[model samples]
Target: MRFIKFFFIVLGFSFLQSCSNPSLYQSKHYVFGTIVDISIYGEDEKKAEKVTKAVLEEFTRLHNSLHAWEKSDLTDLNESISKNKPYKNASSELIEIIKNARELERASNHLFNPAIGELINYWGFHQNEFNSMHPNQLKIKNLVARGPSLDQLHISGSTIKSTNPHVKIDLGGYAKGYALDQASKIIHEHHIKNALINIGGNIMAIGQHGNKPWRVGIQDPRGAQAIAKVDLLDGWAIGTSGDYQRYFINDGKRYCHLIHPFTGYPVQGVYSATVLIEPSQNAGTLSDVLSKPLFISKKEDRKDIAKKLRIYHYLIIEDKHISMTKAMADKIQFLNPNTQKNNQIEITL
Candidate 1:
């Protein structure tokens, strides 16, 4: 049944309903380079269908506007800005995304940088074509020394200009979460009380599964299965970043797409990071972007930065141990497969 898919591979939400009932309605679309799944409950079939349509339409709109690698609205904006065009036009939504990205870059202490698009392409992440070869040391050193950041971006009215000629914007990390938040808005606007949206395993939920809260599986970085599960109440979002998702191995070393802005290399030390935050327009985006900093930050600074960003619940898993905030430890149940690993530790913050 679909519940098995949710509980196992996709890290999706498993409803409390029976498989034979089939009362809940589900719709799936391929957009934003991930499977966008919407499940709606507590509404008639027709209304649920309509709500799903609205949500998918919103995703489509966002995919067209925000995609970095594709030939879309974002591509045009990036091209114009790179060419030093005079005060080019952009949608208000795009402007808001850039603005939020800049704020997040500062809030995360410049760890989560969207302005490293050149470095990203250099590593072949932009093409999904990691050849199991690292970039030349000179190139890496030059990029690192240059240190492009969103601070170089200046937005005014509907136009944006980059103060640093090397600055290039790629919103891949933040755009999916933003799109999911928009989908949630559409679901709520339709008054669909019980709904769950999972975009490439970045999940957000509203209402409940009948009388029970939605249960989500957090995937293990070591394998495809979920090592833990967390119950999510209404208006909560969770996003996870893991090296296992997009990486290539060279010799015995592993390289991933989540690059460290300062070093211009893939981040290490944490295999996976999961964050749970209160819902908002930026909640999903924050969840997605915050995980990188939490995973890559100094051990002592993780909690401080998390709290500074208003993220009360988060988990960081390394090779030998798992550490999490109390808010997360309280809500998560480790699956039996991970019960005796002896590395599950909790922190109070």
Candidate 2:
């Protein structure tokens, strides 16, 4: 569930010579076993650090409370599936997240089930490290058969109970986006106008740098020297999931970290998928969870999923072609196709 972290280096002192006094704010390994980098333009360095630290602390608190992999967090909820147990009440924050997860599960027809902790671990994506071993078909089938449905979860007020004994929830896919949204709220509350928050490959841009939008580069899956750049106009969160990021090559076949819930195996046919979503829209989690399924799904199903979820913009890179959502094609600027000899084409969704 962890996306590869790409560090953007701003090189040379010459680039800094123009700013009157640019304040750089950065916090690494903050939460969810990922590095978070925050850069605020034209803000006091001391004040920026204080705000960043506070936000990071809040994110960490949330992670400790909700992370299923952590045994301590599992104590807070009722684990009994056969009999409903009214355990300790859940925090408001946890309630909100569970609500959002439920909504996403319904919207995606359980394609984005958060209760797939066992499946994720079976595939070894939960370790936050690159997995070189590919699970056998029999193992995948067994894991999928034991996976729980989202409907088994019961939320009564602040309390939650599971109807399945083996149903373990993993918030890795949506937690980062949720943290970004929360951090953005904190920054806004502090009256910060312009900033950039990058948690792994998930990035959120707030306000603007003069008239220019935040420029983000999508890494090439084929291990090219340069990246495909995308320009963002106001505040939006962009996340990219790629099979090329954390994968294993075995017997000339590549196995990716992103596992299909139904098949319980790595999805193929697409190298990468990038999703752009407005902050006002709750599409970040949806995009993260749906990227793999959309890539492996048939063309008609892909279109149907996009329409059903109302995705704003997306780019799908397959072995031989590139497909773009209608919304993405309208705003995206493809730069320098000549830089690479490979064929590049755009399809309207």
Candidate 3:
């Protein structure tokens, strides 16, 4: 569906005192239905803008092609799915993304599902502005019973077909990471020394800002201030999935867009989950997709999921309680000392 998500992580950068820091150039754009910022360090302003413009253009192309409920290639695929029609000439890019998302979806124990777009739409997440209404329980029941999954869609070469009429492809859960990876490639091609790309809250760091690493802050779920700070090394990407953004409250309950494939309802109890991905073949994609299963899984099942996914660094805030892996605890500096002292911060294996 057409979804709008906010930054789950509060980002902060340290800049030099000089009013004209020629070594660093920054620009912000509105894309992916949110604010995207690009910063390049140790590069000329004109070169930075040129490179940034290319990245922005790429983002726009992906946005137009992958939009869930809009008039997009993705929507066209969904239409074909509903009618059991096969797309013979689909773009290679779309096919590759679907295959990648399906792989990640399977890796997530199906918790990171993008196939249930209709379920998301039923919850009023397809609109730019939510009317704050509870989804229909009967509709949810029917959809959940249908149990549309990514496996139902078959892909080979340029031809793609769906076996299930209920499956509606939505890449909202995975597009930011894909975009980040693409942006990184573009910047790397330009031989940019160091750069940062932020799509909504998903962030990727390349090289360093001058001689120091690029530092970022994870926001407090209840307030504006950062609760923790982290330093990003080269080729690292980080993101957070939280109920704080794209949610509605009704009858004293919060309904977020991170819907469960099994229950067909918004997940509760956890305020947010943050994930860090080390430099790898798909670090950006991992950073974006990995936090989702953590937020969606129960506390008891979290460790098993993390182990399965090989996720070593993570932070979870459930209600007022906090927990993280030992690696995360070592890497993050908690900005709120009271939070660190008052709660029994459970360190997961």
Better of 2 and 3 by lDDT: 3
Candidate 1 per-residue C-alpha lDDT over 1-349 given as tens digits, one digit per residue, 9 for 90 to 100: 0001121233333453433346677777888776777877667789988888888888888888877777778778667667877446777878888888889889889878898888887887776344677469899989888778879778888878876767777887898788877887788787789988888888887887767777788987876678898877788888888877777777778787888888888887788889998766667777678887887787888878887777889988887778888878888888865444667575766
Cα TM-score of candidate 1: 0.92
Q: Supply every candidate's count of residue pairs whose N, Cα or C atoms clash at under 3 angstroms.
A: 0, 0, 0
Q: Judge candidate 3 against the unseen true structure and give its global Cα lDDT, from 0 to 1.
A: 0.87
**TM-scores of all predicted structures:** 0.92, 0.86, 0.96
Find the candidate with the highest TM-score and give its number. 3
Every model: Cα RMSD to truth: 3.7, 3.5, 2.1
Clashing pairs in 3: none
Q: Tell me which residue pairs clash in candidate 1.
A: none
Task: Give all candidates' CA lDDT scores.
Answer: 0.77, 0.67, 0.87
Off by over 4 Å in 2: 1-30, 72-87, 129-131, 224-226, 281-293, 339-341
Candidate 1 ranges with C-alpha deviation above 4 Å: 1-19, 128-130, 337-340, 344-346
**Residue 33 of model 1, lDDT score:** 72
Model 2: per-residue Cα lDDT over 31-96, one tens digit each: 667667776755778888888887878777777776765643543452543245654567777767
